[model samples]
Target: MVVIGAGAGIGLETARQVRAGGGQVILVGRNPERLEQAARDLEPIGTATFDATDTDRLQRFFQDLSAPVDHVMVTAGGPFYMPLANMDLAAARRAFDERLALTLGTALYSRDKVRAGGTLLFVGGTGGRRPGVGMAVMSAATAALPALVANLALEMAPVRVNLIAAGFVDTPLSASLLGDQLEARRAELRARLPIRRVVGPADVAALAVHIMCNDALTGATYDIDGGQQLLPH
Candidate 1:
């Protein structure tokens, strides 16, 4: 299995889960040191450092692989939270490229490299389905991912492409963004969400592993947001 965006979040946890399942993992990310640390903890097959948006690099990485992989999990996009009025065109364009375009590139480039019946899983955002204030662009990109993967599933047939739409996972990335407000946000989510707690990386990772192992699941977007979509804003 290859885990793209294998940093300190859902990507990292997914790598851990796959490793726990006795599967070899290859960690890919833009940060060399971070990828190295993540691979060290998981004892992955190896680690590769490169931006997901680089199609040439992604293709070469797969081509150079010694053997075909059974699954490719993408959790590559970063956080972008700003109202349309405050959004910078350059930033929005970059976000779209990173969040959506890169995902498409990875899927297309790895289509043949992935073994038949293998899985291509993407991580999307819950805000796509339930958009809130200051998340217009983010929501737009997130909303497009499921549709994109659905079509890919058809085009890629037996390859089994799917997406996991998550919400407010309590990851290191989120903590850094939230900073001192992390606990406040967690408390608020715990009170508001139907699950009464902020979703953790492990929660989403478990679901991702399930989707990879379950042959019957494909061309679908599974929501694992602790019922965040069920709450009233």
Candidate 2:
């Protein structure tokens, strides 16, 4: 299995779960330091460092693989946070391009490289499903992700494709994005969500591994968001 965006979040946890399931894992990310740390902790078969937006490098990386991997999960995306009133058009375009390229490029390049019965999984956001204030561009991109994966599932039959649409996962990335408001947001969700807690990386990773192992699951967008969708907006 190859886990793109294997940093200190859902990506790393997914890699850990796959490894725990006795599968060899290859961790991919743009940050060499984080990759090194993850490699040390997870002891994956290897690690690859490349900007996921670099189409050429991404394609070549898969092509050079010694054998077709059984699973590939992409949890890579950049931070795009701001209300429409203060939105930066240029930044939104860049965010959209990077998000689409990473998801689509991986599917396009790895479609043939993934063995039959293998899985291609993507991580999206619940904000797309229930778009709220301060997440206009991100919500749009997130909404587009599952649609892209659904098409890939049809086009790449026998090679299952699915997406995990998560919400407010408690990761370093989320903390970074939320800054001082992280705990406040967690409190809000705990008070209001059906699950009564913030969704964590382990929660999302477990679902991801399930999707990878379940052959019958494809072209689906599974929400692992602590029932955030059930709450009133």
Candidate 3:
């Protein structure tokens, strides 16, 4: 397995689980220091630190792999939310481009590098499915990812492609995004989510492993949001 964003959160947790299940992993992350720290506990077979948005570098990483991997899971990047009034057009363009490039680049470049029947997994969000103050761009992205994944699954065939759509996962990224409101947001989710708790990286990791293990699952988007999207908005 090649686990991107393995420095922390969902990626880190998923790598841990895979290793625990007797699988070897190549850990990839953008932060060198953090990735080094993460590799300490897992002792992954290899570690590469680079921003996945660098499409060329990503392609090189796949091409240089000594052997084909059984699975590739990318949990890199984070949510981008900006209201039209306050949006920085340049930043928005980077956000959109980076996300698409990372997704499509992984699918395109990993073609011959992933063993047949292996899976290509990507993470997305369910929160952006609805329209709101800062969700215009996100809503569009949320709608597009699964459709893209579905097509990639067909194009890749034998090598499955799937997406995990989550909402309100309490991770380091969430803490950074929510900042002072982190606990408050947790409280809100706990009070209203049908699952009665804030979703965590472990929840998503378990779902990710399941998707990787299940051969019948492909060209689909699995939602793991503690019923956040099912609630009335």
Give the candidate number with the greatest TM-score: 3
Over the stretch 1-233, how does candidate 2's per-residue lDDT look in tens digits? Answer: 99999977999999998888889999999899999999999898878999888889999999889888999998888558888888888988888888888888998899878999999998888776566787788878877988898999999989999998887899999888889999899899899888787889998999998889889999989988788878776
Clash pairs (backbone) in predicted model 3: none
Worst 10 residues of 3 by lDDT: 134-143
Cα error, residue 87 of model 1, in Å, equals 3.0
- Candidates in descending TM-score order: 3, 2, 1
Candidate achieving higher TM-score, 1 or 3: 3
- Candidate 2 whole-model C-alpha lDDT, 0 to 1: 0.88
All candidates' TM-scores?
0.94, 0.95, 0.98
For candidate 3, report its TM-score. 0.98
lDDT of 1 by residue, 1-233 (tens): 99999967999999998888899999999988888888779998888899877778888988788888999999987667888778788988887776776777877788778988899999887775566777777778877888899999999879999998888899988888889999999999998888787899999999999999999998999988888877776
Cα deviation of 114, candidate 3, in Å: 0.4
Q: After the best TM-score superposition of candidate 2, give how far the Cα of residue 215 lies from its true spot, in angstroms.
A: 0.1
Candidate 3: where is the Cα deviation over 4 Å? none
- Model 1 bad stretches (over 4 Å): none
